[model samples]
Target: MHFEQQTPLNAFLNILFDRYQEKVPAVKKVTDALVAQGVVKSQQDIVNDHIAFRTLGVPHLGIQSFEKIFLHHGYQKRDYYYFEGKKLNAYWYAPPSDQYPRIFMSELMVSDLSEQAQKIIHRYTDPIQADPVNGLNFNDGLQIGEFFHRSLWPLPSKHDYELLLAESEYAAWVIYNRYYLNHYTISVHALKEGYNHIEQFDAFVEGLGIRLNTSGGKIKVSGDGLLKQSSTVAEMQEATFADGETMSIAGSYVEFAERLPLPEYADMPANQLTPAHRRNGFETNNADKIFESTYTGQTKA
Candidate 1:
């Protein structure tokens, strides 16, 4: 598959962001709040550190298949991460250029779950025996954008969802929200004046009436303390299950990240630094808590 480089990258990303904002109202709110606070001129001025996705590890899917789309677009797969407690395998992809946002994709290890959970997952995913991304026309920006929001499987019944929820909240989320944008992080350090740090941005968000994920603390910092992160709690949406039963469940959320300058760059002049001067890649400990943004306990109350 070949990615069409003729299409302006910013235009493609805008389409994805627009569609994502339509589904996740919190994104618009947070961005609007930032603009209202005079932190930036508009959403266009805000830099996206990355966008994340969640998937199920089964034939025809998971990182193996899901990654091909970005890979075709010149993204290079970077670090590999595992969430033992969450039964997840993930990786981050570096963009071909600085103008594009980084991509973080994670897949749930279906076999790692209990038999009942695995059976429930396979009951929905087993029918698709071929990789679905293979059918897409990567050259079409609209088609690529639609693929990200498309439903890959039948919606789960409330009963099955709760059963999986009892085991893995991440599994339950992917079951209903296939290929949905999980969250897009703002590069807090990219902001100017009052909003350049996550701590300041978190307070700014709370002032706008947004609740944060406090599972491991409001801010999850890396061991070296150069990378700090925070996110708003996932929003609850009414979902219609396969049985036509409706229930409120967590949808998507927004994340804020601050990658501080490396120790060596601490003494350098501001004009002398480059993107490489900041901490790169993600931290497992920070991500472990960020993943809790979608848990029922965190989103429900």
Candidate 2:
């Protein structure tokens, strides 16, 4: 039997330390809370304190973009839906796999209308209750509360609903999908030895063959407004692999993008077309690099 050990002096290690530097207050607060509850002993007990991680939530626009991108690819679309009064949408995608870990795309509307959506963004921006046991303070904040482009996964579970709900109605809807995906764990580990690790671990139904969603698929622009497309586990038509082969592998059909074009719903209520960034309590554009949206929504965790 063989086991892989940690990579030495890797990018993950640097990220871990950077995360530590950035989220000290939150870490300390959490640790202190744990210590107070007698779950932890001291601040030193916070092992691998340098590691940073994130939990991303899916947006409505991302879901639409994903549908278009995937259809452009080759994966077959299993199902799709649009919710009324709740600028939310979802779709299921799968490929040829003995174990299909279905990919779900969800879009949350958070613009001029819903106050619930606004409140969720606020909680994400502002984390309350600090922990002093680990000397943790609520500082060196995480922009997660801020609105921008990101892909998150292993959404909040039933138990996490209250916490997520307390944050935003949109989050509540986003996290509810966790039950369908077995509430997997997504940890961004900046390894102590080195190497940045973004792992998505979860159990998919055996023989159900699921594929990772990508953006190489062709686009089918709607004559009117909505775009219609499909995806397959087969190779992308114009896709070329670095190894000099067609880009049609098992998980080849995916949805990814540097940005999501805002939808124009002139016929629909103006409140329905509100952009998520507007409701997201955080700044619109913070990073120099444009964050790409993925069909795998919020795997950034």
> Per-candidate TM vs. native?
0.95, 0.24
Error of 2 at 78 (Å): 3.6
Tens-place lDDT per residue, model 1, 1-301, is 0123547344456667776778778788888887777887777687889999999999999999989888888999999999999999999999998767899999999999999999999999999989999998777777887887777888999999999999999999999999888888899888886788888989988988999999899999999999999999998889999999999998889999998899989988755666689899999999999999999879876
| Candidates in order: C-alpha RMSD to true structure | 2.7, 22.2
User: lDDT of model 2 at residue 286?
Assistant: 13
Candidate 1: residue pairs that collide: none
Task: Report lDDT (Cα) of residue 16, candidate 2.
Answer: 30
Give the best candidate by lDDT: 1
What do the candidate models score in CA lDDT, each in turn? 0.87, 0.29
lDDT per residue, candidate 2, 87-125, as tens digits?
Answer: 444555542331112244445545543565555444442
Worst 10 residues of 2 by lDDT: 281-290
Q: Kindly provide the TM-score of model 2 when superposed on the true structure, using C-alpha atoms.
A: 0.24
Evaluate candidate 1 by giving its C-alpha RMSD to the native, one decimal: 2.7
